[model samples]
Target: MGLLNRYAETLSELGSFVLPAPLKDMRVGLFNTTLANELALPEHLLQPQTMLDWLHSPVTPLTQQAFAQKYGGHQFGQWNPELGDGRGLLLAEVIDSNAQPHDLHLKGAGPTPYSRHADGRAVLRSTLREYIGAEALHYLGIPSSRSLCLFTSEDTVYRERPETGAMMIRTAPSHIRFGHFEYYFYASQKDKLQRLLDFTIEHHFAECKAATNPYAALLGAVVTRTARLVALWQTHGFVHGVMNTDNMSIHGITFDYGPFAFLDNYEPGAVFNHSDHQGRYAFNQQPGIALWNLNALAHAFSGHCSVDEIKAALSTFEPTFISQYQHLMLSRMGIETNEKEQSLAVMQSWLQILETNNLDYTYCFRQLALADINKAQCPFHDIFVSQENRFKQVTLVDQEKTDAWWESYRKLRLAREEETELLSLNPAVIPRTHLLQQAIELAEKGDFSLSESLLEATSTPYDARWDTHPFSKPPSSSTHTSLSCSS
Candidate 1:
């Protein structure tokens, strides 16, 4: 037997209103049996037919309820009062082994109250991105929403072009976004806002409920989680592309993988989402943007908490993020964070080396993992031999700066270097956008094997065998592809 349905039982009490909507031609094209087993879905519900039916059936009997959640957000730093589930629906939540609720959300489930003058559908290109990207984050030991299964059909949607429809079952503890609280607060619905807050506290923030000031504790918990999450993203060179208040999860997971990218060449200012013209959500700006979003979320608590209380809670975000980021970066050099050698300055020097040389982020780190600790020379420079720098547009590297950083790293390594832990932290492979574009192109021409293969490869990304995989290599050209909102 798999998990039992409990979402419908507590759906109303949790403050999410149902907006029942039907989808067309929802046929299961691909099923992720691996994730199904991991999520521990009921044996009967694990089949593709059962998952397909439960997701699309209009008058559903087994765990069937279409709900479009309400949320308000600051899009590009402007208050967007009306933004909610447009192409997605929270179908149901299931009880796992420990009885924790995991939302069985259907992205690309079609139009609801939130679909404003647009077709509520997602294309296969983006579906595969989320499907593989979620699993990749998990393999990298980052906290994120998991993908259960993928479904595709003949349903067509208008994006940059006419595209085939696809949907993915995203698994998360709760689908309640930060914007959910903002939605009710902005609408002057104090009763609904309080109900939402109470429900959140009961289910997700139970620890906070026991605190002296439950509401303040809840905000503090979110701030800490978010800070750590962004720090992980920063060290891993992950650009989330979009950092809207609505896109930020209240539970602090790396959800909503749209136009996300890992570093191709070590450009701190790398912009992955083409739509983000201002570089507000660029690779380097993630830390600042996270704090900005947390500040925006703090405003929602104004009616419930005092100004002093809010300031105190929000104040911890920066130090927490910076400290965590330093520890992570220091660990990358095989230096134990608890030692005196673990300095943020050492990490910055390494970043400056990469920035000056314009090296491949993943490849350079991987080669450094194989470096001889006794050597003072730049060990990963060979990987960039005869290779052009994509960001700096040069074939020559700054040897002087690279040598200086190498000497510093060697000095730190002499004291306390744990190669095993460093290898564990830095991955040998990431779902490169160049390879992803190739896989998506192949899928467009009636071949899904590549996407399937990529998913499998990413599930164990640090495995040594992937070193020979074509995806392990960085792009050879400066013309790297950039994805947009549609992607």
Candidate 2:
């Protein structure tokens, strides 16, 4: 409950107070009833007129004076001090039934002092993309911000072209980022920077306060959570197209979804954000980039932590990430072994098979689990042999080589009981880019059937029923896989 309210007045210099701009013909396009119930939101607030009125003018204790946060970021490895909540506002903080506090953020609310020269509005397409992406990652057992509701308007917004303006209510443990501390630190406002750090620790990372050096403990906690988070992303083949420091959540959840995608084929070098021409945020580069961002954050904590302690905290990233990633990868393969070197070899060889054969990453893993449980229905070759025609650019995997790898894999495979664990670890569905575009196109035409259906599929990704659904397959032909950050 102390999110922004506890410091908005004291930290007025950190942000600006701005009410949401009224949108014409606002309609609730999608809502997360499950989340609403969990938050115990009153039924009246769920109504369109009442909610819209509250967004523009707050009267209930549920909300406070809305304000946009001020922060700066290192974008594409270059420090940019002008970035912040350009079109979003921290409307309020709500404590759910479980007493866990969550920030209620409204994206596309309106323009603010940080909007620069652009209109502070989000298109329906991008709004839905963020909405679907957050939920998809959350349901995949990954840490992520969750969507509360989406409201579309008749007001037109222009990006690459004209589109309907929309707003999404996003919920997260906290909206604080590494950039928040960076902004004050670089501005030479050490007092404000310390205040921000203490506030963040008090509300979010309270467990660190009991340590002899709370600041160093906070850094270590962030590093550990971030390592595990990015490791999960790699095991699931997720590509976070933009890894700017401003987009890095202090809570270590996948935050600021923009130009993000799941790997259709296991291409380690894949880049999904069109603006990333240099492939700085490529799929394979996420772990390195994460460490880089942590190093940038370490600069902000210099006043509170000694260089050696900060380095000690940062040094945990690599081993933590490797341990988490190795465990997840081996679990997906149903390989139960104490030999780390042998398991790493098995994992690398399996990845080579997928890359060499151009197999669908999701399908290959799901099929592997199925073959172990039901070999008659899901043969092992369904991934290697049957998918050869789909990929013409590369030759099929060498049969002799695959046979050798298969023999090595068989020796490490777990017992039959591990099949269920494998199936749960490997999802049968992800929010594929092609399918997301289709949902966006249809939603633009006021047909939300596809979007609704896609949300359901993503929210229950472990269900095998989706394997045969049209949404499960990758794009038949390469459509526009990259995206602009306009939204």
Tens digit of per-residue lDDT, candidate 1, span 82-136: 7888878777666666766788888876676777766777888898888888889
TM-score of 2: 0.95
Off by over 4 Å in 1: 1-26, 61-63, 337-342, 389-395, 417-420
Q: What's the residue-level lDDT of 400 in candidate 1?
A: 69
In candidate 1, position 217 carries an lDDT of 93
Model 1, 348: alpha-carbon shift in Å? Answer: 1.4
After TM-score superposition, what is the CA distance of residue 432 in candidate 1 from its true location, in Å?
1.0
**TM-score against truth, every candidate:** 0.93, 0.95
Clashing pairs in 2: none
Q: lDDT tens digits, residues 353-410, model 2?
A: 8887777888788877766532223245545665675665566568777767777776
How many residue-pair clashes does candidate 1 contain? 1
User: Which numbered prediction scores highest in lDDT against the true structure?
Assistant: 2
Error of 1 at 254 (Å): 0.7
lDDT of 1 at 347: 73
What value does the lDDT take at residue 132 in candidate 2?
Answer: 94
